[model samples]
Target chain A: MSDIDVAMARALLLARRGPSSDPNPRVGCVVLDDAGEVVGEGWHEGAGSPHAEVAALARAGTAAHGGTAVVTLEPCGHTGRTGPCTAALITAGVARVVFARPDANPDAAGGAQRLRAAGIHVSQIEDLGLRTEADALVARWQQAQDLGRPVVTWKFASTLDGRGAAADGTSQWITGAPARQDVHDLRADADTILVGTGTAWTDDPRLTVRDRRGADRPQQPRRAVMGLRGLRPGSVLERTGATVLDTRCPHEALRRLWALGSRHVWLEGGATLAAVFWQARLVDHVVAYVAPAFLGLGAPAVADLGIGSIDAIARLRLDDVTRLGDDLRLMLTPTPDPTEGA
Target chain B: MSDIDVAMARALLLARRGPSSDPNPRVGCVVLDDAGEVVGEGWHEGAGSPHAEVAALARAGTAAHGGTAVVTLEPCGHTGRTGPCTAALITAGVARVVFARPDANPDAAGGAQRLRAAGIHVSQIEDLGLRTEADALVARWQQAQDLGRPVVTWKFASTLDGRGAAADGTSQWITGAPARQDVHDLRADADTILVGTGTAWTDDPRLTVRDRRGADRPQQPRRAVMGLRGLRPGSVLERTGATVLDTRCPHEALRRLWALGSRHVWLEGGATLAAVFWQARLVDHVVAYVAPAFLGLGAPAVADLGIGSIDAIARLRLDDVTRLGDDLRLMLTPTPDPTEGA
Candidate 1:
């Protein structure tokens, strides 16, 4: 592989070490000396921290002069929480720069143009036939920017026959321990965990991410309950501070979540809430935990979404399948409607 | 590997070429000369055909003197269609023999004892530290012998939400093309395909195995309709010569099928019929084709089976998982209850 390919791969690895739930993109930078010897490396910790380029330049010090910097994303030219990365690179006397992805945020654009005007050579990582590996690291943030709303991932656990609860509505444990732990990981990565008032009142879920040993994680997603129904006094959700969005409309609840700066929302809603989101075509992703058991009678996992025939059935493309203990975790995405865009 | 291991592997391969739906076990045999060279090979075609040992001995002719016979099953000592295989082996001057599985049928066993009584050296294939590879070839037959009835495999196709049909009862296609073709192959391997009058009248299914190109296979399984309700006159099942069991009890239906010599029964019954069998614990195996689509409102793939609480839910052990185009084929078996047997 070429030097650019090796450096880009290392940069991508470093980018993933950053906090996932942060609104800012994860970026990593590597500064190579003129002779291509080792120098310095740094990754953005989170928002309000120094950018990757500035951190790497500080670590390089005098060695950064006439050195080349390879980064996972374009160096920002506009100042936000910190100063412009392009100005830091110029002051560090970097001779050449390579970046994997262009800045898609309007406020962060024009970084490459600024660097070139400063008499430094700048080239795209694609020029060397190296694809960006950091796209998934910032996919949710970028999608939120594109849609102007939090990217919704609807998650549910049910038996293999799709029963969410028994006849008496006792749904405490549908899946095994490992599948439940996997959902905790998903919750830890999201900025918000959402449920409906029915779920909050009936199930009284704590709506918090917990470790394998049942201890609460240091970083917890904001919990939100949607629907107009009033929650019971001293419910688990009320006991543990949760935002209550008083709205029956899925779009309105999502808009409220977006206003709260929630980039990715883990929707742990009940059947009715899920059906509404599905009918509104607002669910961006689906995570299903299927237990290897059969409950021949129970509440269905999903309610009616207005589909009355086979032709109108909602189809999804299976993206990933993982065996979690005695259960199966399937990740899927909705197949785009061909007639809608036209 | 030893000489016996090599010969036994080849014998197992030959055994699989026999018809799967036959009542008789598939057996293969290989004759080896004193110099350890294979002189003859043969496999049982089906019932009413020459046994594998006789066929191989016929081909070996004069070369069988003082030779070894490696077989997938013990040579039958008591015969119905032909003479005992032990007599033929002893008459042919076979000096030694090695067999994989001992004959389990009471009426046809004792081949090893008979051979030893005739002063011929007989040993088991396990003595060579090799596993019997032909067990699956005759598993259905052996299971039927043990249970005193046909082994039941309930097959169903449904959407991801466990819906077998839309709200209006339109259930033409739930799974993709590949999964449907797989069901046909299963039907070809079974001795009988069974349904209830509900399915017979509503769906009007032909209940015939067909190839991928929609041509009917030559060896079609016997079709049976089991329910108290009589099928409509000139319905597809009645016109196609399906047997009417006229029973609502799962046990009685199975007893009737056993008397008809149906060793493996593939049940393609509707939801209500499936629930009754499930409640009676008559389902031995399950084959579920899960399509990657969702019908939020519809008839559940399974109806109430008296399961009211999570503790009463029926649990199954996942045996195998296979992807069939846009669907998944899951093979599962019921977990035996510990309390009932004791």
Candidate 2:
């Protein structure tokens, strides 16, 4: 617990950053109590949960002995449906755990080396998993194991002089409508929310995820479409609940859609598939929605990402930095996936 | 030339908006003498000289009697490359003509009813062509002829509160290297310069247009690629002075791209082909280059043309702003075409 109670249990592992399965990252867990308060807080909401340290040690029962649990990765120790958050922090008697970064999944990198070989008193916090809304849940699985595919995070909603619409794509009431229904809870946990084909032919978008419960109670996600084809004859990507992908070879169409399962992908545009998956390192995490308004030129704050200078870029690495409504959310992690283009 | 000098030539033809085909919409044309300063001052720049009213009635050749030409758009009466600018402002006797906007086409819209059926003396200047920066070259060719394509006027430079790089992709010295070598003179009249596949897998780009005395230059627009099949092999779209389209239907993949000719197209991107041509409205125009600094949230400020709200926004309209070096440019015009989908 100390490192500020696992940095407030890694900011409650980002209430599943918009939802889950999203390249599966966002994670938060609390627990505290040596009178420091915050007895239990959970997170890791989708993919069938109980995890986030078994929902904060089942709400920290037995007052979790000497208190302290925190967690934000580095606490899995093998398992699929449950068990082993370092053996549920040694049967919840938890003398000390702390944790923050360190979890590039060799299957939970050995949960703090098996809680220091059972001696407990763990403690780790290396980069307290930076806070861009609690590190877009582990930079969306560390950019899906460094780009095998399924890990694109682009959340933009600008204005503080970043212009998104005023030159004439009208830009709908700039960022109001209650922050565009909070990006549909950030695309309901994104497994797919893409946007292109000229933003669905000038915004004919049904990218789903409603909130005021209007448009027949939306909140869908999985609406994609990248482009090259014309798309009009029956439109909305031929309707019937979407999934269009066609920006030809978009990282081999997202690695054959992550081997036909798709863990988490949400690129959603502003500069063409966010510069085609941040120049195909297949973007790992980024949730921007900056909206204020000036439009000095009118359009372009991010067009063309085929980068021609700075020797072409892609070593990113940051990790987290959050803010939401007036929007902001930088969570990067590149460095280790140039494998020369694949 | 008299109905108040054709109303100040329709207020100097609403100012001088375009054969925006490439930089040359310089239309000027003064001609005041009775107490006013210069007897004349023409301007136009390219494609058939003598435009700005036969270069201000051939520099007011015969100071041409009663003087007063003003002008901007309404002076042509027909003839392919020369002659008839309302018959050289009725043989340069230029008594009065004013002007500013009235050339919407149909063979140069009757030039103020043929300069009031040659009775000369015309007036005008109404919305002064909506007022300013050379009427965006007649709203960028009336938005590429009411949206058949060629309109995306975006310019980009970044930093002033808008950030184009920093959060890891670094953004190569921000906007130096002499404003990135003045965007190759804005890609030499740009007829094409797009990017996707996350800018060819995180910067393996080669959109070309460099120059220092033509450094391997092939000047004058041409270099596109939106979904460029799956290149992992020697990346950079396999190289060789590119021209790939890899169809998926960007409105019939742009009719096999006018059989390899060219007419103007720069959809440029990062947010999935700017959200697939900003939702297939095909971007028509938006040239932003803010520059001052902020990179805050992850990456991408203009990456999704796959539009979402404001009913698929394609009609932007602004036209021309300015600044340049520290960054600004602006100049949009799409108001039509773009029915819907991404």
Best candidate according to DockQ: 1
Report the lDDT tens digits of candidate 2 across residue range A66-167: 777776656776634223577887877777877666676665566776777777788665444343334555565566666566767766665534656655
DockQ of each: 0.72, 0.05
TM-scores, chain B, all models: 0.88, 0.31
Query: In candidate 2, residue B102 scores what lDDT?
Result: 58
Give lDDT tens digits, candidate 2, residues B3-66. 4444354444533332335322335566665444456566665455557667666765777556
The digit string of per-residue lDDT tens for model 1 on B1-342 reads: 889889999988888776665567778899998788999888888767888888888999989889999988888877443245888899988899999888878878888888898888998876433343667777887888888888889999988898999988887788889999999998887889999999998888899999999999877889999998887898988877799999899999989988776888998978888888888888899999988788888999978878788876778888888899988998999887533565
What clash count goes with each model?
0, 153
TM-score of chain A of each: 0.88, 0.34
Task: Write model 1 residue lDDT over A1-342, tens digit each, in one string.
Answer: 678778888888888777665667789899988888658888888767888888888888989899899998988877443236899888999999999888878888888888898899998886434443666667888888898888899998888888999887777688999999999988887888989999898888898999999999877889999988967789988877799999989889988888776888899879899888888889999999988788888998878878888877788998888889988888999887533565
TM-score to native of every candidate shown? 0.91, 0.29
Give the DockQ-based CAPRI class for model 1: medium
Question: What TM-score between 0 and 1 does chain B of candidate 1 receive?
Answer: 0.88
Q: i-RMS, every candidate? A: 0.9, 11.4
| Candidate 1, Cα interface RMSD | 0.9
The top-ranked prediction according to TM-score is 1
Which stretches in model 1 have alpha-carbon errors above 4 Å? A1-14, A30-42, A55-68, A78-83, A125-131, A338-342, B1-7, B31-42, B47-50, B55-68, B78-83, B105-107, B126-130, B338-342
Q: Give the winner by lDDT.
A: 1
